[model samples]
Target chain A: MSIAFFAAFFLAWQYSIVWFDIPRYILTPPSVIVTKGWADIDRLLYYTWITGVEVVLGYAVAVILALPLGLAIAFSSILRRTIYPFVVCVEMVPKIAFAPLFISWLGFGLLPKVIIVFLVCFFPIVLNAILAFSSLSEELSRFSVSTGASVWRTFVKVRLPAALPQCFVGFKYAAINATVGAAIAEFIGSDQGLGFYIQIVTGNMRPDLAFAGIFFLTILGLALFGLVTLAERLLIPWHISVRHQSR
Target chain B: MNPLIELTGVQKVFGAGPGALHAFGPVDMKIEKGEFVSLLGPSGCGKSTLMLMIAGLLDATGGRIAIDGRTVVGPQTDIGIMFQDNTLVPWRTVRGNIELQLELRGLSTAAHRASVDELLASVHLEDFQRRYPHELSGGMQQRAAFCQALVHQPATMLLDEPLGKLDAMTREAIRTDLQALWIQRHPTVVFVTHSIEEAIQLSTHVAIITPRPGRVERIISVDLPYPRDFEVKSSPQFIGYVRQAQEIFRGYGVL
Candidate 1:
């Protein structure tokens, strides 16, 4: 049903542009974009690969740092007061504004793009982790105490599993932002990647190719978001959100 | 023989400075071995607070609690505590959740395999062992939690209104399930509940507590026969005990 709806919608979009006598630069139809994308499929896939690497590497770094830091903030008041405010201040700064600084410092290689992605994804994952780790049930906490569970055992068995669903909320958000972050970083300064490709084509009056750039970027974003959703279903099958969706 | 549990002038004050709330206590009581003692009180009367103190999960502001002659300064190891919410780990199946009890205590789940199965069977959850808590109904989830608490065969069970959220039918079934389990294994149980009749049904001794800064209002010796089913609830003697408790509540202007 969803596939058919999209197909019909695209057909209408294709004919409507022609009926309105829209020029190719002003409004390239989906068919033109697809044909142009197919003609440059090799370059498009190559750039997608580059942006994909940036998104994945940056997201991985963010998760590795943010999750534990968030847990620390939740576990100790001292860390929460001392470190969290600084993290919030960093997050408060417009991340795009840091793109030039990153490019200047690290150069326009993969590093800058990856750093931008990390900056974009880090806060959400950590904030959710903080919320997830601390929101334990009172009875469950008492249960841990009564059972003589060591701190490590309780964390592994109870705390980690309970936090997964909420943590995934952050993960999903980070995955989506990762693509946008990479794109924006590339836009500020880069010779490679889909963002640079789209910008160059748009400047050269090839709206069709720009649309093709957008097409691949959207695919990368969807792929990451969909992967996270799938993992969430697999990991926390008993979660209310997951169970409700399956029904 | 020394009592299995003893409390001496136990008090729990919420805060140190002025405007402190005295949640419960200055309570003193002794529970004999293998006795089912219910702490009965109205809602917000601190029955659950008092239970936490005995479990050694919450420290008393004043007084001492000893279990088997050992002072309870930290969390007691030989007890299974259940709360109103089932608290079954949502990530685990019913069987896995039950096994967590033994795993937490650093005991081998393989060694206690027989008892774990027996506990599951007693609760009629043998078939649903593979299912998660979310898939189970309210009664079934509570039953799974009950099994989880008992899998280790703890010497004491601290139950804080474990059936408060269930429907009337579900509550009755679980109450019976609890009675059967207690009869089979005689663990020293400290059950906290707000219902007068429920206390009478399960407890050997009903420790009625007054509201706010709850003190022991009266200790009613039920002396009721075991397998205290619905028939017992309607029995003349059972009716008399309920009336006696109601009359006492009247004295406190609570009824």
Candidate 2:
């Protein structure tokens, strides 16, 4: 049903562009964009793969770094107090402002793009991790303690599992932000990636090609988001959110 | 023999200085071995707090608690607790939840498989052993929690209204199940509940507590026989005990 609605909407969009006599440079019809996308399929796929790698790698790195950082902050009030303000300070600065600095530091290569993605994806993972760990029910904690579970055992068996549903929430947000970060980095400085392709096509007054690049980028973002959702379902099948989703 | 559990001058204060709220206090009690004692009181009467202290999950601001002649400096392995919420780890199946108790005691699954099976059978949850907590109803989850709490056969059990969330019918059924289990195992139990009939039905002695800064207002002894069923609740003897407990609660303006 949803697919049918989307198809009808796209057909209407195509007809509306022609009916309104809009120029291709300003607004490309869906049919024209599809044809242009087919013509540039090789280059588009290549760039899409590059962007995909950067987004996935950056997201993986962010998950690795943010989970433990969040756990550390959640476990200790002193550490939370000491480090939270610094995190907020860094997050307060628009991450895009760091694009030139990253390009300068790492040279306009994959490293800079990856770092941009990492920076964009980091905050949500950490915030959600902190929220998940800290917000654990007191009853659960008490039950764990009553079981005479060691601090380490309690963390591994109870705390970690309890925090997982919320952490997946962070993972979903980070996955989407990762794509944005990669695109933004490519926008500022990159020779490859869909973002650079979009820049080239638009500069050459080919809105159809630019829109094709955008179409692939949207697909990439959705694919990444879908993968995270799948992983969440696989890993935490017992979570209430996941169970409800099945229904 | 010494009391299985003892609390002397035990008190809990939430904060310090003038703004401090005295939650429960100066409460003294001795629970004998193989006894089912219910701490009954109104909500916010610190019944849960008192249970926490006994379970060694919370420290009393003043006084001390000892179990089996040992001062409770920390959580002891011999004590088991079931909270108001079932607290079943969402990720674990019913069998997995029951096995957690054995695991914590360093017992291998192979060694305790029979016990786990028996517990599930006793609760009539053998069919649902592979189901996760989310798949179970509230009563089933509570039963799984009860199995988890007792799987290792801890010497003492601290239950904080473990069936408070169940519907009336389910509550009564589980109450009977719990009584049968207690009869079989005879562990020293400190059951906290707000329901007067629940306390009377399960406990050998009902320790009626006052409101906040809770103290044992009185201890009402129920001389009912063991292996009690639902029929016992309708008996004249049961009515007499319930009326006596109600009268005491009314006297303290807690009813």
Candidate 3:
């Protein structure tokens, strides 16, 4: 069904410019975009690689940092009271505003883009993880205690696995945000990456090239999102959402 | 011998200051070792409150509760408990959930593999051992939960309406399974329920509680014989205990 939808949508996109007598420069056909992308495969590959790095690294750093922080905040009143407010305060500020500051401070390199991506991905991961960690069934809590489970044991054996399904909510959000974040960072200031390539192509009035950059960016975004979903399926196949997916 | 569980004027208040809510109260009871005691009352009459206090999961606002002559200072680790909701971890299969108890207690789940499978078999959940909790029927889930509670063989079992969520047929089936498990190994049980028949069918003694700001109105012994399954539930003696409970509940303005 998804394939059919894509095929129909792309077919319309491939022919609509000709049907409407639209100029080639204004709106490129899907075929033109694909042809141009394939002709400039090396350049597209290079820029896509750059963007992919920022997407993966930035998101990875956020996951590594935010997940533990979230779980910590949930587990400790001290962290919840002290750290969580600061997190909320940070979240309140528009994440895009950080792109300029990051680029200026860190310079126009991969570091700035990565930081922006990390910042974009951080809040949801942390907040959702906190919710996931804390949202336990009273029954499971009682059962864990009844088994004489220590705090650490309970967290590892009971709390962690139970929290994964919900934790994936944050992870998925972070994954989608990662691509946009990298794009924003690159947009604000960068000489390389697909985001920068699109800027260059659009400036040159080569909409086909710009469209190809977007196509690659979309693939990158979907791939990262799919990675998270795949992990969710693997880690928590018992979750109702995942269970329902198979059926 | 002293009772396995003792409550001396135990009461629970939810909060303090002007907002203090008297949940349940100043009721005392003693439960001997291996005795199946049910704290039976109408809904919202603090039946589960009593169970939590005994489990040491919830603190009493006043007085004291002790088990084996020691005051319950914190959540007791040496017991099994079941709630109305089947507490099976969604990520685990039936077998894994049962093994979780031993795993949490720093025991080897692999060593107890046979026992875990045996627990599944006892509940007739062996066929679905590999299935997740969400995949099972409500009765099957509760049965698995019952095994999860019983796996470690705790000396005292605090079961708060384990069969409450199931339909009548499923409840009856699991009730018998519970009896069979208990009969196999007579752990001291403190069951909380609103069902008088459920109380009488399983309990050796029933402690009737009055409505809100609940206190134990009286404690009556149900002298029915072993394996109080469906047949015993309909037995004249079982009906007699039911009437006795109803008689006490009647005085408290309950049907």
Q: Choose the strongest candidate by lDDT.
A: 1
lDDT by residue for model 3 over B8-124, one digit each (tens)?
A: 999988989899888899988999999999889999888898888888889899999999999998889889888877778888888888888888999888888888888888889
Question: Which clashing pairs does model 2 show?
Answer: none
Instruction: Rank the candidate models, highest lDDT first.
Output: 1, 3, 2
| lDDT per residue as tens, model 1, A1-247 | 9999999999998999989999888879998898988999999999999999999999999999999999999999999899988988887888878999999999989999999999999999998999999999887888887888899999998989888989999999999899999999999899999999999999999999999999899999999999989999999888999989999
Residue range A118-188, candidate 3, lDDT tens digits: 99999999999999999998878887887777889998898898899889999999998899999878888
Candidate 2 DockQ, CA atoms: 0.70
The 0-to-1 C-alpha lDDT of every candidate, in the order given, reads: 0.91, 0.89, 0.90
Q: Is candidate 2 or candidate 3 better by DockQ?
A: 3
Q: Please give the clash total of every predicted structure, in order.
A: 0, 0, 0
lDDT of 2 by residue, A107-202 (tens): 878999988999999998988998999998988877777777778878877888889999999999988888888988998899999999999999
Proportion of true contacts reproduced by candidate 3: 0.93
TM-score of each: 0.97, 0.97, 0.96
Q: What CAPRI grade goes to candidate 2? A: medium
Q: Model 3: which residue pairs collide?
A: none
Error of 1 at B129 (Å): 1.3
Q: Each prediction's interface RMSD?
A: 1.1, 1.5, 1.1
